[model samples]
Target: MRQGLILVVFAALLPVVAASFLQGQSALEDARKLAFERMIGTASAVAERQRDPFVIGQHLLLVHATNPDVTDMTDTCDAALRASLSSYPPITNIARTAADGTVRCSAIAFAGNINLAQEGWWQRGVSAKGMTITKAPIYGRIAKRDVLFLILPLRSGDGRQNGTLTAAIDVNYLRRALHDAGARNAGTLAIVTRDGKVVTDSNNALAFKPAMGAEPDQPIEARDKDGTMWIYTLHKIYSSDLFVVYAEPRAQLMATAVAQMRAGMLLPLISILLASIAIWVGTNRLALTWLRELQNMSARFAKGDFKGDQARFERAPEEIAAFSADLHIMADVIDRRNTDLTQALEAKSQLTREVHHRVKNNLQIINSLLTLQSGRVREGAAKEVLAQTRARISALALIHRLLYEQDNGYDRGEVAIDNLMAELCLQLRSARRSMFQVELTCHARNFPVPVDYAVPLTLFVVEAVTNAFRHAFPAGTRGAVHLNLDLQAGDAILEISDNGIGYSVTDEAGQMGTELMRGFATQVEGNLSIISSEGAGTQVILKFPLPNMSITNAPPLGSVPAF
Candidate 1:
């Protein structure tokens, strides 16, 4: 709660701090403007000294083809221009050509003669109207310098083109000029064409760094490292849209703004701290009241008063408002849950009663079928079959009885194999006491098979035992009937063996019982194997896959075929 109060107070004070700092930035801007103005003035002075359009024009106008005292300008006049311009420290080499399409170049300061034609700077000036001017950036081999070749057209007083004169200007001299104009700063400054081509820079560190694309073209307004605001001032040279820059750094000025911000936050922080203390005290009182109410409400619920409200007289501070709302919602939810529980209990009771009634009805139907079949029997063999059928029905009836007695009928209880087998044998022995004796053995404990699977399995066992008795022991012959039931791994294997004469799989001539056994095994999702030799016993093993999913531990009642 105290932490929350502190955060709220801090949020309210943060804006005052931001605005105070912004004020210092405003002052810094004014100072930067003043600083750049002085730098620009200095830059302008250096530019004026280098400006000489007329002097350049006159130097070009002095040459004429008819003035014999001077050399014929037929070819060498252009060479003379280059030589003359090279004499100045600021120039390296120059070239010239008449407007009539002739050109020359030279290696000496004013004497080494060479001739060339159709020069770029000469063409630029001649193609221009009147006494046109042009400047070309070039890298000169002899001068070993980056220089600008300036071409000026010499014209008659009436503006007729006589010829063109050219001069080369040293770039280093321009950098020196910008140096005095306070160009020593972290960021670079350069003179550039309006097209973003760099002509010169104060430091010349990145001699030809590309200055175009997504940066400010004119003066730039931005904040500095210390959040001190300032502006950049730019100047354009008159003739060619060439530009220069002056920057004013302003970090020191923003400290004033930082001071104002600290001052503004002081009052709000103190007030918030005081407010937090008061809220802390109020929340402490309200929390104790809520805890006591919770204790009383839980006690009432323990006494079975589920309808009692959980928390009342609610007085929650903002810090605990969310927790209080969640508690109230929880109580409303619990009240709804109790009502649902009562309805669910009554529904469960009705379902159990319905299941019991259905089971009784089903058992009656099985008994009726058994009674009707027993009444229709005439011959001894027929009566014996009827009695066996009755025993099979009883096995099925017992499964239903077990299901209805258990809590969750479908999933619980196993048929006791020993007891089920004992009863089946007795029923068989009573119907017909042949010389054949039936021996049943089980190795595993009793386990459940779901009613659906166990019903078919029970009937299958009865049919196998009856078949062995009726057919395996012939007249004046004696043999034993061995039936073994086992639960192993994933399947319950039922092996019924008889010392009867065996037959081949292909010889189904009179083997109705064998075929039927195969069908029954398949019906219960199991496999049947018949092993028989003339001298050895015939063993029929039906691997009835017990419900791998379900089992119940219950004591076996005598050895019997369990459902």
Candidate 2:
């Protein structure tokens, strides 16, 4: 129930949480887009400033190329180049080279044997009629510094190349120009070549190598050599092969937006947490407490305790109070019904026992009559028949007596087969004629069976043992009669064997006993087998299934006193 309440609260608050998250994400995206635009603008400004030095150098070279002193390599040409270099701090040197690659004039002094014959920029300049710039910065031999060169072709009247005019712009001056332009920006600024070379950087501490594949005017994130993340953009510098890079730390760029988003989301999260707590507490107080009390009362009722107090639920809700009242009424009804059933069961059990006692008394009377009749008979055959009849009657009487005699709490109608067999063996021993010196030994295990099963089983044992007593021992031969009842698998085995002079089945005297024993075995759904020979002893074995009932209360094997 508490979990259900929490689920309800969570479901109710889920939409608010989702909406806040989406709104914060949208705000964050907007902040990032604005930051990207500002950084692009700053980069464009720096690119423009970086282009200025190259543009100024091109214009100066064009002007100087037309002067007579510079073209003719007059005595004042070196002085003229020096004056131009001093005026533009970014231009490190100005020089004029002859078509054959000899240096005719230079602002910076060097060995006169130095030639521009094999230089790539000079060869290209001599071939082209227009101004040209170097692809990347190079170390200037005359200026002794890293520089980018601008070249102009000097031509004769027929348009043949006369010589070339070159100006070397210092790399340090380009870096200063980049810094001045982006000083107000938040991060590093740099000028890079088309092939990802860093020509000049405002902050050398960071790796300013911009990606060559990056599109211009767009921002992308990159990690530097020191594992710092940056958001930077690239802008081309005015048709030149150089690019300006503006970069800022990613954390700084998104800090304000992240803070705002977190501030916006905090309240809703706290509200959900508090609401869940309230629901949990409120549900326990209002409903679960009363439900728990009702549960306790029901458990007690299951254990037959119906004396739980109902007044304790008077202050509960109307539904709970009414439910408690109903449970109390139910408990009363069940208790009364249980008492009535118990009384009726006891009365039935007593009547059944009384019936068994009367039957046993009547059977014993018949047995006594048979004994009297056997005593009067003079013929040997007639006396033997009467004695056998009396033994059969006595067996029946014994079953009834066992049924009624049991004071144990188990059903009185059921007979313990082990006890019955032990008693039967005792009776058989007592009844044996004095003429036969026969010993009887009984070994049986306990099995409680209903009267229906007990009757046939007891009779079967008696008939088998009696047959062995009469036939197996002849002329008063000393022998033993063994009766055994054992349990194996799910079946019970009853064996009656004797060590005496055995007789064949074809003999007239044994036929009747065999048929009678077979009938008894069929009645109890058992299989009967007789093993006998003319000289050896006989064994009558009866195998039958035990009744399907609890036998835990039955005594263990060898527990019953055997005779």
Error of 1 at 543 (Å): 3.7
List candidate 1 segments past 4 Å from native. Answer: 1-379, 407-436, 443-448, 473-494, 497-510, 544-563
Candidate 2, clashing residue pairs?
none
Q: Which 10 consecutive residues of model 1 have the lowest summed lDDT?
A: 63-72
TM-score against native, each model: 0.36, 0.62
For 1-563, candidate 1 gives per-residue lDDT tens digits of 65676577668766864564565466556644554555455445544544443235335434422233222354554454554454456655444445465443332344444332356655676556543333435664445677665555556567777565555556676667656543545444566655666666665333232333323324455564556454444555535445554444444323454455455555555666677776677555866556556566667655656554424444555545555456556666776787788688657755654574476467658767867877887768677656666766666665555555545443343454444455555555554565434443323346655556666776777777667666666666766676677777777888878776554545553276677677778778899887776566577788866665555555532244322
lDDT of 1 at 85: 54
lDDT of 2: 0.82
lDDT of 2 by residue, 100-209 (tens): 98888999988858788898878887887688777778899899999988888898778778888998889988877767765676788887777777777875334646
